[model samples]
Target: MYLSLLTLNSRSKRALTESSRPYELHRSLLKAFPDAADGGPGRVLFRLDVNEQTGSISTLIQSEKKPLWTRINGYASFVTECKCKEFKPALSLDQIFRFRLRANPTKRMKSTGKREGILNTTEQVEWLRKKGMNNGFEIIDVIALDEGFVKDKLTDTDNTGHNTNMFSVRFDGLLKVTDVDVFYSTLRSGIGSAKGFGFGLLSIAPIKE
Candidate 1:
């Protein structure tokens, strides 16, 4: 019943395009654990929390108004896996992330959902290039799913409320992306609002680092 919301910097959504900051950090344990100094690739600690929201990864982004120009359309959502071949401490809740839960207003509560967190994944990835990656670290590897979370979330699970897979890994990664590639619509009709079909990430958990 609780959905946490995180206004992430699209760029940070490395799993979407580049940089696996968290994954790389996790790999640190094996390469630098017990030797994790300030600048060394040692065992580092970090915590990430996602805010509450609604709708499927596909239902979110209503348009591309960020640059207030380009013709960006449709948002994207996908799972990313980092190839940190080596890990000593092993990625756990402590090393991966401790999810913070929050209650985000549903479509019924908010008015502008579509324009809020919906945009093209490719365009998003491209935009991020201009924004520049500056997390104070180097990126190792990345694997992005071509499909959006909304489309991917309900693919395996029954969209029907009776057997909904509300808790699936659409865009799995170490650090979090502010706009985890989702769609929301507040409009009653038109291109933005889903009318009733909307989705968001839930019960997010990190895999073994």
Candidate 2:
């Protein structure tokens, strides 16, 4: 696996446009990995982080293959810095870490049998807890920050003519690995839904005692 950090010049118009439209940004990021350009099976997960006070913007990308960021046209002009590093984390049962996940939390509607965004803060936390249960980890403490809704046009699916809205929530907290194998898988595949729109990437760091 490879981890990349791309710092973009907020003053660039292109950066401003893509940042606001996650779908476009996702497409732009895919250019770095040619194998994924044709809608291949390669998985690329990313999370955009913005600092409102300093107006700084950076994106964290995790992918199965190494990315050639220079392939993205005009990257040198709009991107201030691009760094990529191989990632391999050692895991063990009962290991604790601080983690962050930008996920589209949702619940299935009993009547419609369709998934709906979960709005309640309490429910959002519960959603993560439930995910942890099945993903081989246990949430020790966590908080959810509402990130509003992400809007994008559906170009590929059957709902191509319409625009879709996905509620976004940011989760930050501490977790303990209950099952190393399962937790490792979760780290690679991510959590929750709407992954294509910058949701479901789980970032973590070990908590030093």
Candidate 3:
């Protein structure tokens, strides 16, 4: 496992295009690991953090072997820096940490027989609550950013010939690791749906003692 951070100028047109079309960005990111280009179980999980004025991309890549090369392009400056390091956390039961996640919270509407995103603030919170339980973590304190969530229309068209809509919510909270193995799996495989569109990358930091 490798953790990587890429800082991009929000004003750059190429950055804007890559941000809008997550599929394109995914392909671009995979360029680093040629072995995974054809697609496999081992892949990269990425999240885009953006504000009204600033943005950055963080990714967790899983590869059995070291990548042939890692590179990034399309930035305001000629050199687009990408920092990477081995990701190996020594986790234990009841270990507390501060966590941040950009997730797509959704539920299938039985009435409509269609998968629908959770939009209400209360529902959004509940969605995360359930996810935490299933993922082997307990949320001690959590808050939703951007007024619960934001909606994004994917720039690339899907099989239906229509843009896919993604509902993204940022979660900030303190969590205690319950099941170490399960938690590790959650960290690798990610949470929820629409992972390709920059959703479901869970990141964490140690809590100060």
Model 3, 125-181: lDDT tens digits are: 888888989998998999986433333444445444445666777889999999999
Alpha carbon lDDT of each predicted model:
0.24, 0.91, 0.71
TM-score of each: 0.20, 0.93, 0.82
Q: Which regions of candidate 1 deviate over 4 angstroms? A: 1-95, 98-122, 125-143, 148-170, 176-198
Model 3 steric clash pairs? none
Query: Which ranges in model 2 have alpha carbons more than 4 Å from their true place?
Result: 36-41, 156-161
Candidates' RMSD to native: 20.9, 2.1, 3.4
Off by over 4 Å in 3: 9-11, 36-41, 54-79, 146-160
Shift of residue 116 alpha carbon in model 1, Å: 10
**C-alpha lDDT (0 to 100) for residue 138 of candidate 2:** 100
Model 3 — which ten-residue stretch has the worst lDDT? 70-79
User: Which is superior by TM-score, 1 or 3?
Assistant: 3
